[model samples]
Target: MENKTIILTGGGTAGHVSLNQAIIPELEKLGFRVEYIGSKEGIENELIRESHPEITYHAISSGKLRRYFSMKNFTDPFRVGAGLTQALNIIRKVKPAAIFSKGGFVSVPVAMAGRLAGVPVIIHESDVTPGLANKLAIPFADHIFTVFKETMGHVPKEKSTCTGSVIRSELLDGSAASGKELCHFDNNHKVLMVMGGSQGSALINEAVRENLDRLTKQFNIIHLCGKGNIDERLEGHEQYCQFEYVTHELPHLLHLTDLVVSRAGSNSIFEFLALKKPMLLIPLSKQKSRGDQILNANLFKSQGFAHVLEEEQLDAHSFLAAIEQLAAEEEQLIHAMTEAEPPKTAYEMAKLVAAHAK
Candidate 1:
């Protein structure tokens, strides 16, 4: 059999690239050569380059999909046009059998280019509602895979299927003992992990710091503080360990965690659910996002998988109280999560993409 090639395009944020990360190995195992197209300096480029160096990475112009007015918005359409041309050239050159898009601004052009090149395109939507870029790319996509069942109603039902989230397999094999050793946590205390998405959250960082002294008394804390968000003032606290960000060690850190405090990014929250970790979610407010995080938090809360604390309501007292509440209700959350269906779609998705390959 001839070696087939596929192109994966997603970027701008970690959420857009995570599904690709989860599916790449499966695709490789099935004998597909994978290539990635993203912006020159987007988080996707950094993540793919660092984690999967074997993937051929292509950089294209990136345009921001803004909902609000900005001067850059005027110039960005041209950027998108340029990106489409670049993607078209790359698609023509590589002659990929199929294109898999994870849905970001960078994906719009690639999806369009793939359609024009007569390559089958598969898009995965991670949010309850389609994001702007995905919304635009839908017409060009041959198949749309959704994480939420409700999302199918919003799209052309004929083209969309509910696949659940693609969770990284390594996350399931984490060693609790290794995690405990890494954080220096004793069995006497429960371990709490705070994550603020990939870039870190200033709001969450401040809240955690203000409540650290009180929190440390009950739980050992492992905080993934995001790049450049670490506090030098809290450097020597034995009960609290801080990392600017974690990649290879994330699974171990998660394994040791007794509870999680995090943003309601779809990928991260779904991972927490997969791990059956009881969580307190502080979603980004409408001002910061398109309200997807709020919807994600609400869905998890309604399903009894998590507790939601709006960022507007977060303070040191409220934060501590929420943690306490999550602790009290941890058993219920874990039970609900355990009863829920696991996301077993990585292999299924890989097969679906390969089936479409020319």
Candidate 2:
């Protein structure tokens, strides 16, 4: 029990890092020293270093794991090899009891290093189907945790388990008034929050902006427009608030929101489900991704937790119509969310890790 240190790794996107962020404080409370290994420039470094200053953060070289052909494909292996060496060196110094990975490209090397270092590597997969990194890291993982039960079929059955969703406790503690004050938004109109994931979707941003005048008439807006995606023209617009991204402020924003229009990332949708927000989902198309968002969105739609709008059919008019439809179904969606399974708290999930740790 003396070596209660644990190493957490993930990055590239917010989805890959959320579960790790959620469990960090609980891990600390359980007396584990949490050290993180992430890519030098990935969002994970900014998030963990800024939000959890007590945790030691390590930067390692990592390459993107792309499905399509890219010139980087030829050079990424050398970068990955360097990352493995870095991760193993870190593992040797920390001698963590367990290494938990959320399955991003950076995690592949970390998981491999953990196996070589004889550390128990536990991975959490948030999509219906595994991501490319998780698929590659599965062999190195001692156990894989999934948010979707269907994912069990994609990984080694004996080594994987469905733990359902894990939500951060602070996300549920937000005050609506505090959120309203933060945005300077009056309660005259209901608030609608639009998120296009951590990277922001240009398609979603354009549609929302083109229709902003129409939408602002009915609702106040909080737009998480993604990094470098904010339009300078919209800076002083009344009833519209835009941010490149948010970290700790997200919970308050969610508390202030009455409706949501967002990408169908599992972590985000599950957070909406926990908050009982009526949502209109715009999933990333198969052309853009592995179509994991399409599956995540459709599942929520079937459960009555969301209204799905495919990219092909989305336009200025359809975007407004979907918002109207979501508003009309608000009560029903809330009821459905009420009946759904609640998410695990950070402490409970941390305990799960401790139970399985080497």
Candidate 3:
């Protein structure tokens, strides 16, 4: 019998690609020939290329789907059309059993292409609100998986399943001692991790830097400051360590984290939840995004899984106070996290996707 094959599509941000990463191994283990389709210049291309060389990678043309006005808006529809054509060609050639999409602009064309190719498409939405790209792809999707129960109301009830998020297995096996050794910090002080998502957050970086003196006195800080966002002047600080970003060591760093200050990206927050790390979320302001982060942070806060300090309200002083509050409420947050059901594992999600395949 021919080996089963599946195509995974998603990218724009790490969040969009992360669930695919989590499930790829499971899919491989289940005897599927995994393939990926993403933008030529996207982070997904790099990430998938470097991490899973076994899977074939196809680069396709994709245009950003912006809500606000731009000259690109007129031209981007043509790019999207070109992307759809490219995706259709690839899908027809591969003749895969199913297409799994993590819901980004890149996945929109791919999802449509899957529909046109008569391939089943399964889309996973990570946020409380569906992103514009996911909204556009919904009608073409045969099944929809969501991280939040609230998201079901927005989708066709017959097609939507609240599967929660998929947490990578590697993240759960981190050694805190290894993290402490890597960071050159002793176990005497609490370790605080500040992450600003894949692209980094200027607001979070500045606020954390401004409060470093006060923060360092209380905790050892591991700052994943994003690519090219590191402040060289603070490189030699005794109690603070900063990296452009971490891949292999992220698990260790997360394991060592006593508390977290981060953006409310759905993937990162869900990972923190899986690890039971108490967090202070500073979501991007409405001006910067579609307000999905704000909603994510609010959901976490309401669920007692995290504390939120909106970007508009964030300053050095307030940021520090929120950290203190997170520290004080650590036990409550951990309790909530412990009682919370973990998301469907990658294996389970893979099975669900496979069951929907042609």
Candidate 4:
């Protein structure tokens, strides 16, 4: 117990950092000192620094992990190599009990470095299929934890376990009164929240905005529209509220939301299920991603937790229709969520992860 230090690594997007964020306090309270390694300018830096100032944040050199042919591909490996050296130095100095990675490009070097430094490395994959970064980091991982059982086929079964989704503890503590005070919508109308993942979807945003006049007549709207995408003209509308992105306010906003229209990212949908929110999911098209969201949305639909609207067919009419359908199926969705396996708390997940520490 002399060395309680553990390093958390991930970044590039909010998705990559959320699991790490959820586990930090739990890890800290369990008597571990936390340090984070992320890119100099990645979202993880801002998220960790702003929200958990007590933890030390280490910035290392990393290049974009690309799936397509880019000129930078030639130079990125050098950056990755540099990143590995930096990570190894950090790992040796800290002598952490473990290294937990919520995989992103930033995590690849850390995982590799952890292996070279003889530290146990654990990875958490929330998608049904591992993303490129996770795929690369898997070979270096001592153990892999996944949110979906289906992900087992994609990972080394001997080292992986399906732990189900871990819902952030703060999400369950939301106050309806605080939520109501934050968004001044009429009590008579049910609130519908529209979130297009962390990066926001233009297609989803367009569909919502175009049908706003009609949609608002039935339900009050809360929109997390993504940064720099807000239309100034929509600012003063009484029945609608928009934000580029939310950090601490998310739980309250979700508490006020009776139903949700969202992208089918595993993390977001599972949070909705945990909250028992009936949702209409618009998954990003295959052209836009590796189609992980499509698989996630389809599974949720089969489980009765959501209504799926593929982006290829997304339009204002279909969007509103999906919302209407979600409302009609609200009770059924809640029932499904209630019957499903309950999610793990951040503390439980943190401990399970710590079990793999060196």
Off by over 4 Å in 3: none
Runs with alpha carbons beyond 4 Å of true place in candidate 4: none
> What order do you get sorting by lDDT, best first?
2, 3, 4, 1
In model 4, residue pairs whose N, Cα or C atoms come closer than 3 Å (at least 3 residues apart or on different chains), thus clashing, are: none
Residue 273 displacement in candidate 4 (angstroms): 0.5
Q: Give lDDT tens digits, candidate 2, residues 1-358.
A: 5698999999998888888988998999988889999999998998888888888999999999888999999999999999999999999999999999998899999999999999999999999999899999999999988999888888999988899998989999988888787788855799999999898989899989989999999999999999999999989777999999988788999999999999999999999999999999999999999999999999999988999999988888899899988888899999999999989988999999988786
Task: Write the residue-wise lDDT of candidate 3 on 224-266 in tens digits.
Answer: 9999999999887878999987887999999999999999999
Report the Cα lDDT for residue 155, model 3. Answer: 89
Query: Estimated TM-score per prediction?
Result: 0.98, 0.97, 0.98, 0.98
> How far does residue 265 in candidate 1 sit from its true spot (Å)?
1.2
lDDT of 2 at 249: 85
| Top-lDDT structure, candidate number | 2
Model 3 has a clash total of 0
Give me candidate 4's TM-score against the actual structure. Answer: 0.98
Per-residue error for 177 in candidate 4, Å, reads 1.6
lDDT (0-100) at residue 118 of candidate 2? Answer: 98
Model 2 CA deviation exceeding 4 Å by range: none
Distance from true location, Cα of 22 in model 4, Å = 1.0
- lDDT by residue (tens digit), candidate 4, 56-117: 99999999887689999999999999999999999999999999999889999999999999
